[model samples]
Target: MASLGVFISCTSDAKKTNDKAKTVTAAGDTVATPEAEVGTVREPVDTAKYDALVKKMANGDTTGNWAGRKGPYPLAGAILPFKRIVVYYGNLHSKKMGALGEYAPKEMWSRLNQEVKHWEKADPSTPVQPGVHYIASVASGTPGTDGMYINRMGDKQIDSVLKIAKMQNAIVFLDIQVGLSTIQKELPRLEKYLKLPHVHLGIDPEFSMKDGSKPGKKIGTYDAADINYCSDFLAKLVRANNLPPKVFVVHRFTRKMVTNYKNIKLRPEVQVVMHMDGWGEPDLKIGTYRHFIFPEPVQFTGFKLFYKNDLKKAPNRLMTPEDLLKLKPVPMYIQYQ
Candidate 1:
């Protein structure tokens, strides 16, 4: 939470004049100014070649060329060689979770497969991993029996999504919306599922309720410490199970949702992807990505496309694979809600 006081304002204003220019970290917080330089200045990454590569990919040239390849990280385990991960985000029992939940199970899987095939046709060399990202733990507007402001799904529900992913040899992501509960409380409950090699995790900062407010009443946040705790938790699981590194995805659209990104520890056993979870027309979506996800550097990145929200505009269309491939750092993971 941002400090609220005259002192805080004064301090923020003081940073504006420092020789070490204030810059936004991946978490969207201003970096602290140091009294003196501590290390050699780093050169900016050259994206000219990367842009050309994606441009070619966008034009239907799959000839084994792509940027932001997700391999050699070794932490990704059997799902190695990261390519594009297209996920259907929703809950099987609720229509509000997203598009993935609105259709019949078989029909939903069919739609997901069709999208996967589309991407494969676009870029044969880059493998597209299909995923069903289920909201295993839902954030409730009212606090439940545990006063966590959350409602967790039963094992049967989780297994349903897991089974679908397995049928397609795809991966499963169990997303957590903590509400008034802390990660400490909600994450451990899902450890059993996360122990599986093919299963990963997603945390929604929008419903975190860092200030003890009800979910959906106001936006929430997750500090770097919270993120680190999740990483450390998953790293332990991988070590204990002798499994591959797990991907820890944290969804964010606004800057405040994630604070102090520089402090987020990247471990060999865990990969972090800062996912852009926003909804709008193509232009608004692109601007949000450029302003939020593009400037923030993390281990990896993801983009979310909302079927209903996206179609609210005149075009009434969702972004195609070609349209999204143009992003500078091609999203390693893409989600449809």
Candidate 2:
């Protein structure tokens, strides 16, 4: 079952308009230009607390980390609030040849590689390039799954993704199902790919159930311990490679997906983002962000607009150039079909 909590200040509808610019309507209420609503800048986050959190993670300590932090906005840095043009490259199975379970053929691989290259080269003036996050398949080689039985396409898949990242200098997100393995256990295997400067991590908590749990069950819950394990490992790996702090992406559709989520201690050096993957209408997208996302301390947030699914339901409300601009804490990443 899903749970809801009210922790942050609700956004008011009182339009704060500028004398110079035109007003706009967002979330059913007319609002002034974004610049007019800039209230007292939120105080800078306490760096001392952030420093202590990093030390605790490095030492494998999870205690007291959750005690000090509060709900909603725990950290700060709105300089580049997330934008809404992010694209999520999910479903590698669709890129495979023949039957759904068939191995991804060389032809399919080449085609996908070329397509990604094109996206990388997309004009920067267009909000499509450099911001695309390619999600690698986590269920590819797992036994008993539809994608299993094929030769393990481990580094081969990683290599293809890296090529796009290097070509566009874009961020590459490694998606992990963690079906049967713990995050720690899977880290070493992915070290070769993770060491790349552009690579980041995406955890599919839906498939991170403990042993004996059924698939599609409400199984994965990221507690302080789990987050510490992830942060510490990635921090060390990134430092060893002399790369910038790694981005850790967590997916959540309902509240239960990330129990005690607000308490997860993260390193300041590492960028952590919680993405709401509730796919459906554009209005649903707006509501989700206003109700669930505006409260979180995520460094960035993502929105997925289905080229086919979205067009089928509310063809008129499909996200447009102007609609994309109004997303609060502008979406850092936008996903397409």
Candidate 3:
């Protein structure tokens, strides 16, 4: 269980600079200096060239879902096809959670930087964007007092990751695994940080547990409505703050994990990525992306690589940037855990 301090601010000044683009990372009892604006936040999305870019992002997919009938023209600072985002995903508390937790800070950054170079070399046309994806809401083994079975990481936990990303001027993603809770209840809690331009969001449907079962006992699901709720939530924040577009990520490995793909709405303020979160040998992983992710297109596509799980068996190997770029509608958002 989290301590009482988890709900409270870690530092007195943490909340003071939150609503601006220049927020700070919390450190012990004080916050760091105000953050410099990161990423291309103010440049408006060009409607004159938007359609051509989305078509290029399609990479020859004949499916009618490429751009997916958008509900809003994107605001300035959309970073989808313009540059590929390579991210490290994990929870900070446990090493087993992912690469972010498995290695010391120095080693983790070295490994991540190596990946950024790999993708850049493989696809020179699309510059690589660095990002850190932290699991802000983890699905726990036992039900907590609220019966949500979720372990919510608070101000200190989030501040730690933000501090690290600040070094490279990289983006930060706060992911959610709702367990028995709903998106409506969980997302609003992080508004203080989400209001910033560089901090984005990701939702894992595998642990959603919509039917009231324990999180790990079975894979969970999220319908188009749940996804729409998050999009609307982030969209409102963007309009209110005049910040850059937030890249909203949805994790998927199965068809049921995300239902009614056609009904999920897109807004100018939010860029939705339907990420392939499955893990396996090359062939199996490729099949999962083709069967589940490729067929029903969202606004953007992302691929997740498992550092350990992908190499567990014979012929074990990780997929290289060159390997992923070969797919139809190449994934613009790449995640490693």
Top of the candidates by TM-score:
3
lDDT of 3 by residue, 66-140 (tens): 644345677777787678999998877777778887787778899999999999899887888898999898888
Q: Name the candidate, 1 or 3, with the larger TM-score value.
A: 3
Model 2 global lDDT (CA atoms, 0 to 1): 0.47
Q: Supply every candidate's count of residue pairs whose N, Cα or C atoms clash at under 3 angstroms.
A: 2, 13, 2
Q: How close is candidate 3 to the true structure, as a TM-score?
A: 0.88
- Ten consecutive residues with minimal summed lDDT in candidate 1? 2-11
Candidate 2 stretches with Cα past 4 Å from truth are: 1-88, 91-93, 96-137, 140-153, 217-220, 312-317
Candidate with top lDDT is: 3
TM-scores for all candidates: the values are 0.77, 0.59, 0.88
- Residue 215 of model 1, lDDT score: 76
Per-model lDDT: 0.70, 0.47, 0.80
Ranking by lDDT: 3, 1, 2
Q: How do the residues 197-303 of candidate 1 rate in per-residue lDDT, one tens digit apiece?
A: 66799998988887878777788999999999999999898777655668778998888899998788877778788898888888888888777776666657788
